[model samples]
Target: MLDLRDHFFVPDAPAVELRAFTHGLMPKTVPAMMERFVEDWRERGVDAWNEVPNHWRPGSGEVVGWWTLPETLGDAFIAPLLGAPAGTCIMQPNVHWTVQCLLSAPEPFTAGRNEIVFSEGAFPSVQHSVYQWAAMQGLRPRPLPLGADGFVHVDAVLDAISDRTAWVFLSHVGFTTGEKLPDAALHAVAEKAHRHDALFCIDGYHATGSVAVDVEALGADVYVGGLLKEACGSTGNSYLYVRDGLTLTPRLSGWFADADPFGFQKQPQPHPDVRRRFLAGTTAIASLYHAVEGLRLLLDAGLENVRTDSLAKTALAIEQAEAAGLTLQSPREAERRGAMVILAVKDAAALCEWLKTQGVFTDSRQNRVLRLAPFVWNTTADIERTFAVLEDGLKTNAHQHVVAPASAGPVT
Candidate 1:
């Protein structure tokens, strides 16, 4: 029997050739590719104004810039997630960075000040970042909780709105149950926010490349996504989009954000261009280049194909888990789900370890949910192999405590 762990395990080969359905943390050739891309971009007059030092060095390429290659890859992959145009601004490389940048902006808020709202049960990092941003701006942040259906209660979110609400932030997909928020319902919420003169932002990290995305059609003011989740890219990078004509003051400013970075004048001027204004510091050229390649690969393979295969694999896993009497945590409806499927089982951590011994690879969440993320590289065969290992692991659960030997201390 084929081992799922063997298929998904990170290989020692170069990242350009490595093929595995991973969490999209970091790819192999990212660093070198980024450095080369940046150098080429500079040679093409992209950074002529900045006159920034050629920080790319041999052997010790680690200190190239403030952001790493993984960070750049993370950001670039989010472009598809945000449905932003090719030249859209990316503030910060991760979701937290994007939220913080938005929150810190110098926008004025009054009694009718625009409000920001989000579903409560969304990623805590994003929620907390937005909350902190609001506090810094002296604005109240509102969180509407999800319903028993494990989906964000749209009515509840709408009802929480006040004249002061300026923005509505939400996740395109639920992390806990892998439920997709209705696009029509979300668009209605966006309309409501606009009616209240507020902006709507979405965290598409969970949705993005995993599902079909068309930012223009969604009509959101801003959208954020991380490459690691669905884009088959590295971590530390993320992307954000601000609709074509929407204008807002950027809270964070860096040398790269200046309109004429190469100007030797003591006073610096911010770029008038929307895309350049939000960008701070230098680009993670190495990772960004690799991420572009990964994105191209996904696009070439066709997103529809990826989605179709992902859903089939998820369904298979769910079927097998249910047959084994494991509680399902993911949403049942196909329209309400994404690539990752969740299974609620007792002793999930132990199960994960046991499955590892059987060469089955999977992840467990804090709450007793086992998460099986099958990506474009995964096949139906992998799903079957995983289920077989899980079946064997379940059979040995009763004797696991005494039968599994304790490990000795590592060598000094």
Candidate 2:
């Protein structure tokens, strides 16, 4: 596997960070990118929105200004991560905003279709948006429970699709369980949705950068995700991809999405470019400069290799966990696994805290499952070290006695 640890500023040496599934290590290049942002803002002031140095693609001689970084970066960096073509992708502030915009658009809910289908395993953003939109007087939320196998019930999802279904939303990877739905299953769902004249949308928040995603193959009319996790980009960096020929005029769109903003017309007009219509209000230029640095490293290293590295380390983790008598909550097969592995444990938060004290970082969910994703920056040795601490902690029940620090935040 390609060892790109040197490319990232991994957290303090001798400390193992197993929480790539939550947040990623900062790329060494971010400081320089931030400096360039300051230089551009201080030098040009308001004019920076019109024209700024192309720090994103320096040698390519591309004309990138603060005004166009969203689409420009989407075309150059986010497209490859999604395996999507240029002009079909654009940057958004977050998945919540993107999902809200899609729900607010009238196109998907037209033709008397009034239902949206998704699994209960979806992240709160998708679930919350669907339920919130139900107050619109005609829409119904169809939430299917996971199957006995603890993964999305493919048959139930397919059977739920009907002529009244206006849209079908699915997570490319189950957020709580770390199960990645196979492409064949997603294709089946997409075909059923298309037959019923419903739009198929996917939330790839946990799959992007860690897995090779081909939006076309999955038949997704729309896809949304962020770079805050394994992609290593910080907050305020998310992206959306709309299938070609799809038309959506978001009721939630702001002045930035207007076809002629400077015209200040009384009427609102959607931007001609479908992707640009997702933009709302002024762009956050500072976040854009550092957004693609982590992506650059991943693309150069190759996503397939990244997945391979993750699987190898996670397999080792599972083996060690089993030897230590830890129960697995995530998929045992590599094909069904995303980047993270979840272990069923008692007092998970306390164990997580104890692990942190030992220089091994991990997070827990709902006080039952501890989650970890071994990325390219992690080694098999690190996994072994983590398990060693975990085994000793559990054997002695020492973690149970430790109290959470008063300063610790709610999130593990």
Identify the candidate with maximal TM-score.
2
Q: What is the C-alpha lDDT of each candidate?
A: 0.64, 0.89
Query: Distance from true position, residue 101, model 2, in Å?
Result: 0.4
Off by over 4 Å in 2: none
Q: For every model shown, what is its TM-score relative to the native structure?
A: 0.80, 0.98
Tens-place lDDT per residue, model 2, 37-104, is 89988998999888987887867775667877899899999889988999999989999999989998
Clashing pairs for model 2 are none
lDDT of candidate 2 at residue 89, scale 0 to 100? 92
**Candidate 1, position 277, lDDT:** 61
> Which 10-residue span in candidate 2 carries the lowest summed lDDT?
56-65
* Candidate 1 residue lDDT tens string, 63-147: 3333333333223444544455655546345777667766666552545574667888778777888677766666777877778
Give candidate 1 regions above 4 Å deviation.
1-22, 25-83, 89-91, 108-111, 264-268, 402-412
